[model samples]
Target: MKTRTKSEMNKIRDIAEDYYIRLGKKGRDIADMLGVTEQTIIAWKKGRDGERTWDERKRDMELTPLKIRELILQEAHKTLSGQKSELDADRLAKLMAAYDRLSKKTNPRTVMDVFMMFDNWMTDEEPDLVVKFTEYHRRFLFYIIERES
Candidate 1:
């Protein structure tokens, strides 16, 4: 049997983690692919000592906007690729809406961009209301900051 260094073992573990969490592979399958024992993969999934478990990592990843977007994209891709029976228009639309909502929540810059564009349009079209709009915009910005905090 060949001896593996700490770095090599860590690299293998990382690959296993990605397969199990990101690619949704089973531990036994990952172990077979990585040429490691199933027990080793199980241990890694459960976490060594104080480290976080693979399930915990997966849950955390699922909670993130980026991960949610990735999942939505994956589902869309599957549908487009004919892996799924048919294109679920309603489901896809809902997923995209959820993705947009999550994206806006994580990225305040999107809100700012939309607000700036609207403010510019208001300034040009309704010049007299600019002062009131400015006050409202200020309050809105403060509200956004408060919501974020």
Candidate 2:
């Protein structure tokens, strides 16, 4: 049997914590939305929960819309901290809803994940459609990924 260390458990909760932070309009709201116990949220945040439990499959093979919306906001937050662009609240919310509706049972890997899997999907696997996204403007996109991750 494999021994799970404290550090390992902390790491598990950490995934939930960081992603949860990225997930919410407000941190508390996310706790409600994820339907996870509040203790779980705090434990995850404190890096103490070894058994981080909840659905982590991301719906299916594609990125769930909720996750995607979160990513877009994250991207916007990172890429437009002081730039000319901005995401409107109403539009953002609507997009978030759309994302949720579409990705209820799907979680997209990353744009990087898509790119990495391109050849396999093209030759061996057949997806309904192929998707490609250029960096928001190339320069900042990389920075956004770096700063956030």
Candidate 3:
């Protein structure tokens, strides 16, 4: 069998990492998909040498919506800071559009916000059920928070 170059091995490892962490794929599945052995994938995940494990990388690289939006804005600023060109302008436009889309009001509100709005409406429209609703709402909110955690 031909030996792979360092760059080729690094490329394969990066793809395997994406499949395993970002896509939440199993080691065996990733190995099969990438034409490697399950042991190889496992070794990569566990950090064969002194390098950090895939799980550690995943934990460190968690991306939230706000973080993504910030990245887009940063990219836009970088694009603007470069020399002016048509391609740079186009890239900037796309980045700005992505930032605007991410910042839109249509983004999901927290469960508490939605529930509080509903509670207020119910208090105004049907004040008699407020006490019972509050009890159930508190339980439901805790359930959701616990599940999310």
Candidate 4:
């Protein structure tokens, strides 16, 4: 492919960054969609090569109820799938607690409350399950958000 001119590159970056922030697209995914190298997307995000970056993008992103459900399920799957030992009740409890919050919410406010509960669980380390669960949530959140959008 021919090299993109500066003006053309700027226009592309503007649109791509909008989607990257608004739709939660990953750098690699956006790069593939735009026929650019993933490194170019990373460079654009970093404001290198004179391209603008989507600063404060993470602050704009918010989690939904279904996102929390996927987080819970993915965490459970990750934890159980590679375990050489049996999953103890404590590990199972973490997943159950997250799911329980989702199951009981009947209003927007309550759902947000449940979301916060799970968000806090992301920092938990007692059973180690919560930590790994949080990692999976972070890893999948971008793809899930982009897919929903």
Candidate 5:
């Protein structure tokens, strides 16, 4: 296995912790999947053996998911704008998967509703058409966000 930097390790830990919360995965299961010891997973979770204080670790954990999304979008924009020959497809895909997994609760309706509130945003005359559009968006998002393994 390749060695991971502290930042990378923390990101994985955050994802695993979130998985544990959302899917009822045990720390041992997460550790086994990641090829880490249960003790290490516990340490990371408890902040008992980590270099940073609990608050700092918590803050980083909280921001990691958002950061992953930002990085993926930024890199995609860079690629699309011809600023780069090619983006890291593997990294970008992993980042997107991670973001989608962690952001499963993100409501597509909230966004569509906000846009609909604006005048002339969605000019569909039929109410059923609007409902169908909203449902399509919601299903589209769900299709992209892979369930936790």
Candidate 6:
């Protein structure tokens, strides 16, 4: 494809807006169709501010939730540098295991299955079960979820 001119970018923005209103597709779909990445679509969608050049176009986008997760890990690594605390150790090990499993393309432990299991377990609320689980995270997750629902 030829390098996008201002008019071409405006056209892309209009089409992208239409795609969003029609089906709420992420910019990624438009990018894929246009033979570019989602990021380029995002930038082009943010038109130049009274200028004709790409430099005036939007950049330095917000951190997505996934990227925010990485930032959180980085902050945690920096802050948890002490000899150790139980909370720090457990979280650290869990993160390391996740990173290793994922980077190696191994069968990473799935959280959705665990979510489902918790979901099923929470559906039953026998008085005995509630009292037994009162001090546990399962109780808190279930309580909060039920309240939100």
lDDT winner: 1
**TM-scores for candidates 1 onward, in order:** 0.44, 0.25, 0.39, 0.36, 0.33, 0.28
State the weakest 10-residue window (summed lDDT) of model 1: 104-113
Worst 10 residues of 5 by lDDT: 115-124
**How far does residue 56 in candidate 1 sit from its true spot (Å)?**
1.2
Model 4, stretches more than 4 Å misplaced? Answer: 48-55, 61-149
Better of 4 and 5 by lDDT: 4
lDDT of 6: 0.56
Runs in model 3 with CA error above 4 Å? 63-149
| Tens digit per residue, CA lDDT, model 6, 34-100 | 6667887667656457644232221222333356457556656666665334346567668666665
| The best candidate in terms of TM-score | 1
In model 2, which range of ten residues has the least summed lDDT?
52-61
Residue 115 lDDT in candidate 3: 74
Cα lDDT tens digits, model 2, 1-149, are 46668887556555565465443334455557655556766555443246333334222323645467777687467545765435665666677677666655322335444554563565455543333223332443476466556
Considering lDDT, which of the candidate structures 1 and 3 is the better prediction for this target? 1
How well is each residue in 32-146 modelled by candidate 3, as lDDT tens digits?
8988889899889997677889998777657666787766667666666774443466766786677677556332225666777888999999998988988887888787667
Best first by lDDT, ranked: 1, 3, 4, 5, 6, 2
Using TM-score as the measure, name the better of candidate 5 and candidate 6: 5
Cα lDDT tens digits, model 1, 21-93, are 8678998899999999999998899988988999998888667777777778888888888787344869888
What lDDT would each prediction earn against the true structure? 0.83, 0.52, 0.76, 0.67, 0.66, 0.56
Q: What is the lDDT of residue 146 in candidate 6?
A: 64
